[model samples]
Target: MASVYKSLSKTNGSKEDGPANGVKKNKQRVLILSSRGITYRHRHLLNDLASLLPHGRKDAKLDTKSKLYQLNELAELYNCNNVFFFEARKGKDLYLWMSKAPNGPTVKMHMQNLHTMEELHFTGNCLKGSRPILSFDSKFDTEPHLRVLKELFLHIFGVPKGARKSKPFVDHVMGFTLADGKIWIRNYQINETEASKVTSADVEEGLKKKEKRDKTGGGKETEISLVEIGPRFVLTPIVIQEGSFGGPIIYENKEFVSPNQVRSEIRLKKAGRYNARAEQGIERLAKKGELGLRTSGGRAPKKDELDTAELFA
Candidate 1:
């Protein structure tokens, strides 16, 4: 009888028909890992990114590269809906993969110009796990593939509200700029200071006065400025897969050239230079041989018909 009453209450709810609370929950968790053979710089970049994401789960390095489908199972194990993966080649080239776990549409990008926060030594700093405001270039909205990439970046980097371990406040901004067929990433701390200052020298004094006012107990807040806190890098998108790690390709960058191809072209140019020099040397030797200028190997000069030796003979 109790079960029947509960069923009726659930089925015949005319007073309020929607969700118990008319609020949508934005819940997201990410699994972050890298393939083996990544250099220390790549590892440090991964660490810096993981530190920034409160909802991310960092795991051991994946052992296989060819079978990326294994990541789906790993994400499910960790209750993660997104995966951020790093794949390294030749211990130097780093490629990043961002995907929605257990589904389609994955992005693969080649990473370049990486610089870690430790190396950059920027004065800007923010609280660990603090949420960041994402800023994207206007061009991201203009194209279809760029829009897809923008969405992926939003899901992986944007900290969801009420996420576990996330700070309640936002203190940094992550800027994504599109230029030269690549995505440039930068992080900046939101530095709040008094807005009345007019010059660089006055700015420090103004901040000091503001601090004193606060200590004495009350002052109005001022405007904020950006100070770079960097783990800077660029990514050139190579392809977008329709599935998490498998499936048909939805988009491919025709302008993007692989690092291997670039290196091979350089090698060919060098080889061509050497071959040209070798051919020049052979031609020079043959010319010397025809003139009988070579001491060791050359055709003797042909005797003229009117030469003194021929007439005397």
Candidate 2:
């Protein structure tokens, strides 16, 4: 596979002065592992993932004994920063461990489908490509799993459960459902169905339901009224790059406001009262000529009269 890429890169079509495959060599190195010893399916997944992140070098293929010390050694050997591990379980369930080398957080996940890959559509396009891939199996792609999958995807991609893109960067979603329990994700495109398709009566019915929800704060409050979000199709999962999930900062906030900067209403009211009383006290003193060095016109004297500079000296 490396030879193929090297050969293709060799045809410079022009200079061919430097290493043609240098670009590929610079990609991040990774090792794929699986517990219960790697099976055929694990290799398939590793190959597909390597192809997806073509820039990355596959330092080593699936590992049978995915112990912690071995993983540390592999990372050191290849200077790899990321490693993906899969643990096969009873039926078709799988536990996924994404180990970030040199002390980064390992994202752990459990997935459902494993046996259904052949029947499922595996695409040439990577998950991060603009047009994401999404396909659902009509059989196991039903209730509970489907419902749970929806919730899981929403949380992972930083998308609102109400189906809104909280941040513009995560606009695209790649997702699909499988019979055995595996999920492939892709971005979502808005449907071309026109708003004119909805009749005036439908709008009226929607408004009534919304009004009821507003008054009661029931689940129906979330019932389909606004159509900007709540896409009818499946959503995709977010892509992990550089062993880092670089999506928008949570709550659209990179850092929190300092405690001193947060001025509550109570504090503001107290401050206003203190300022007002101070001003009133000065006014009272000035009226009775008690405030030091007042002008004849009853205005406070200028700083020149106080000789603050001389006092400091």
Candidate 3:
């Protein structure tokens, strides 16, 4: 009888406030960090994103870039399920990495045209750490890789319910749109205002509802509008790895060109122009020597009809 009571008590204690069949709740904590060489803009963007994520843990600059799998251990240390990493290269290019820590399917993207919230000067604002509605373009559902990207964005950007630092209100929206093989990100504030509309039919009603409202003054209808709140950036997917920052690449963007190559091509073109000008000058000098128009080996100057000596004579 005592054993039965103990068993019942044990079962009662094991019961949790979650769904049945062993499904877990959507609880996610993210580790946000960047490599050491990031510039001011990259740091600001990181801060902006960190501020928006109440459940994210921001750490100091990572010291190494080669052993990125160290991020998994760091995430495990912080009890974070997701990792958001900013990798800076050549002190100018910024790459973003998103991964499910201690697992597979990591995404590496080249970030471009990033603007911090302070730089944008948008009038729209929301309560910090407030939950945001994620609005995705229809294109995300069209392809397999896009679907994977959408899942990553949802995991990293979506604030779960009852986040420790999150506000109770949902006051903003995060928009992700895919166009021209890149993802564009935008944030907007949700503005609610009392919707006041008086039509001819309402006037014909003899102001009955207005008189009722004058007596009561209770109900008000609001219209919801979206105003731009920014920290806008674009991401071009470069590759998807099979592990956390490691493993074989599952997807690669063949069309994506490196910034180094682009810069080198521009430099080569300029050098080609300079080389052509130098060759033209050399050709002109050769032609002058062939025509005996140029003095050689310190030879005496040739006397011409237009020479100063001849003119003075």
Candidate 4:
């Protein structure tokens, strides 16, 4: 007799859908690093990149907006084995990728350097085994860089002199296949996840709730009535993660009661920046401490007192 399970659909999860059968799934971890600012163009590029990979492959696009350290974190998060750097802008923007894992590769792209020859030489030493792809836009001539690049590629790929002439020197700025047949292209646009927005109705409802509380003279009302107000700005030192990008911290007067509170507020912002400056040697000086905080302290140190040498050192 025929088995009753023979006609079952794969959707119900059966042995036929299992990997034990001849079926195999392709899993790829891809990281896209782009220097272009996020724009509508990115949407198009993202779609194209999605098409290049096999189905079921995981992909992450790290744009210029992302923190420098986040790139490394993402590499670890996705177990990325290959990285694609998309240089979409002009001028030299230094790109460096350092892998903590011994097995991973390091890739660097130095665009439009005044010292092209020297830069290429230095890059050759830094990125010995890894593939380094240099891109030049229409404004810049690739001829000079190409000359050095050709020699580098020849040394690495071991191309015969005659065969090198026939091979296309530079791939199209938009897209091209690597020596290994891996497809790579510089696409300006790609899809990005957007933050959700609250509607006007939501704001109206919240205002109505506040009106009700005002009428009820809610004992719980903690609102402060200010007679005088002035423009105020808060400066908070932020720590930037090694592989992540860092930016300014702007807060309205309503946000903090004191400078000390800024640290706690920042913790709420992103756990990564919490206690950043303190770890780097910045200490908050209270008024009393500022007067005679140190053994030799007299008055608060001037702005120059903050030594940034440690950062560069």
lDDT of candidate 1 over 97-180, digit per residue (tens):
999999958999999999999999877789999989999999999999899999999989999977899999889999999999
Q: Which candidate, 2 or 4, has the higher lDDT?
A: 2
lDDT of each: 0.90, 0.43, 0.88, 0.33
Q: Which regions of candidate 2 are displaced past 4 Å?
A: 1-28, 59-66, 89-93, 114-118, 122-184, 187-313
Residue range 133-228, candidate 2, lDDT tens digits: 233445433654344444333322332222211222322334454422335443233222132254443353564545634654544232222212
How are the candidates ranked when ordered by lDDT, highest leading?
A: 1, 3, 2, 4
Query: What lDDT, from 0 to 1, does candidate 3 have?
Result: 0.88
**Candidate 3 wrongly placed segments (more than 4 Å):** 1-17, 20-22, 197-221, 288-313
**Residue 185, candidate 4: how far off, in angstroms?**
7.0
How do these models rank on TM-score, best leading? 1, 3, 2, 4
Q: What are the root-mean-square deviations of the candidates from the true structure over C-alphas? A: 6.7, 21.4, 8.6, 27.4
TM-score per candidate: 0.85, 0.33, 0.80, 0.23
Q: Report how far residue 47 has shifted in candidate 4, in Å.
A: 2.5
For 160-206, candidate 3 gives per-residue lDDT tens digits of 98899999999999999999999999998876645565433334344
> Which model is ahead, 2 or 4, in terms of TM-score?
2
Clash number by candidate, in order? 1, 14, 0, 14
